[model samples]
Target: MTPMIDVVFLLIIFFLVSSHLSRRENRMPVSLADSATGISETSPADDVFTLTMDAQARLFLNGSQLSTDVFSSRLPRDSTQTVRIRVDRSLAYEHLNRVLATLTDRGFQNVSIVTSPIAVSRP
Candidate 1:
């Protein structure tokens, strides 16, 4: 009985350590684009991927910075996967265009752009 209890305890410790080491990726802060029609919305579906670009034109996926090529490599090769681009308004159109083009060329066709609702104040 003592040996069995020791084995179980070791197994539990091993699992706890491995779980911490293998945690899922984290998401970084991204300021969404402003939209007159957009309001508070539900979270994105699990199948949908989000790509973000900050004011400095840095690209991120789930919080980690990566190049466009590296980003594409991480995605599924098929066209069925959907992605959302949360680009900073301060970024240039050319930068956004390049991102769009790259995703399209890589066969990710069903992509959406995420935006926040513009707060309208009455004078």
Candidate 2:
């Protein structure tokens, strides 16, 4: 009984640490573009691969900086894997397009451009 209880406590601690790390990885600083029509739905964390492009057009995969070539090489060829791109609003469209093209060429079909909900204004 003692051993079983100890194992259960260890497992609980492991899960808590891992979940916190995963959440931190996705919280990279990137000012997302605003979209009025964008839905607020998000896929399960395990099923989604997150990419971020900052204002300087620096690319990051799961909060780790990497070059475009490296990023391309790391992408899974599975078209069914969901990809979420969080790009800074100030970044140029060309940069975003390049990333999109890479994903398309890699056959990623379920890509999403993550954006912030537009703030409603009252006059």
Candidate 3:
């Protein structure tokens, strides 16, 4: 009985630490662009892949900076995989377009640009 209880406690601690670490990937320092009509809801599906672009137009995959070639190589062969791109608001359109073009050229059909909801102005 004592050994069983210790194993359960260890498992619980492992899960808690892993969950916290997993969330750290999405907390990169990119300031997302704002959209008045953007849907702010996010899917909880594990199949979703995220790519982030910082203000300097540097691309990151899984919180690690990667070049376009490496990024393409790392993409799943399933063109239908859902991809979410989060770009800094200050980045130029050309930078965004380049990423879009790469995805489109590779036959990715389920891609989305992530943006924050615009703050409402209160009088």
Candidate 4:
């Protein structure tokens, strides 16, 4: 009887550890785009792939910096995959155009540019 209880305890510990590891492996963060208008009353969907660009032209995926080669390799090859690009307002047009071209070449036809909602200031 004691042996059976010990086995159950071990199984529980194993499952808990495995779950923790799985959750830690997926750390991608979704970035929201800026908009001149206010946020909608309804909440947006949580599932999305986000790409970020910084003022210095640094590129990131879910907050993790990635080179052009690395980014291209990691992109989903599926033609149906939806991609959202979040570029810093300070970034140059040339850089943004390059990224868009890369996505198009990689077969990601459905893509959206994200932006922040406009903030209303009280006079």
Candidate 5:
């Protein structure tokens, strides 16, 4: 009985360590767009469009506040141009969806959400 218990504990320890190592190695950076793999080869445009949503649900474009209507109007007519959205993780899904809908209505198809590689620490 004692030997069996010891063997079980050893197996548990081995599995725990192996699982941790495998998980760490398998970690892939989370990206909002599927084409992120080739993003580096493409040069960012001088006129890159960006929209940011703060935790308080306030929106900003390149550090300037613009009404949703105004921002929507500023989206490029070219479908190939990318629109980047930087959103705080804590922002509500409903608010995010509303912003996405606004962009879709404006015909900005190639949109990307910007996120830090690792989650930020809460204050």
Candidate 6:
């Protein structure tokens, strides 16, 4: 009876600590760009087009804000450009999907999501 009671108490404490840890992660900015096996290529400046999205689902292309209509126009119609898209985890999936659909329509087949490798934080 004593061993069973101790195990139950230990489990309760473990749950309490783990719950707090998860909440802490939520308090920070949510970014989906965390990857372990990301491509390690140093692409030429001219060949890479980076698309960034904020938590509010706002899209920016190379630091310039453009509407979806204008975005489609800016992309080269004939060139098969490799675009790297970095999206915040908090942003809506629909926003990213919309941009992907547009890119596919424009014949840009090589699209990659940019992400950072997850590393252990040592305190």
Best by lDDT: 2
Clashing residue pairs in candidate 1 (N, C-alpha, C atoms within 3 angstroms) = none
CA displacement after TM-score superposition, residue 115 of candidate 6 (Å) = 0.6
Give the lDDT of residue 27 in candidate 1: 49
Models ranked on TM-score: 2, 3, 6, 1, 4, 5
Candidate 5 error regions (>4 Å) = 1-42, 119-123
Instruction: Give per-residue lDDT, candidate 4, residue 14.
Output: 100
TM-score between candidate 1 and the true structure? 0.65
lDDT of 5 by residue, 1-123 (tens): 999999999999998987775344213222332331333315344445667777767677646666766867777788667776767777787888988998787677778776544334678
TM-score of 4: 0.61
- Listed per model in order, the count of residue pairs whose N, CA or C atoms clash below 3 Å is 0, 0, 0, 8, 0, 0
lDDT of 3: 0.86
Residue 72 shift from truth in candidate 4, angstroms: 0.7
Looking at model 5, residue 122 earns an lDDT score of 71
RMSD to truth, every model = 5.7, 2.1, 2.4, 6.2, 17.7, 17.3
- Give the per-residue lDDT of model 6 (tens digit) for 1-123: 999999999999998987775344233343776675766747754576667777887777656577888888888665577787778976778999998999888788889886778875678
lDDT of all the models against the reference?
0.74, 0.87, 0.86, 0.71, 0.65, 0.74
Candidate 4: give its CA RMSD in angstroms.
6.2
Best by TM-score: 2
Q: Give lDDT tens digits, candidate 2, residues 1-118.
A: 9999999999999999889977865678888878878676566787888888999999988678999889999997677999988899999999999999999988888889888887
Among all windows of 10 consecutive residues in model 3, the one with the lowest summed lDDT is: 38-47
- For residues 2-63, write the lDDT of model 1, one tens digit per residue: 99999999999998976654332224565666887743435445666777888887788767
Quote the lDDT for 40 in model 6: 77
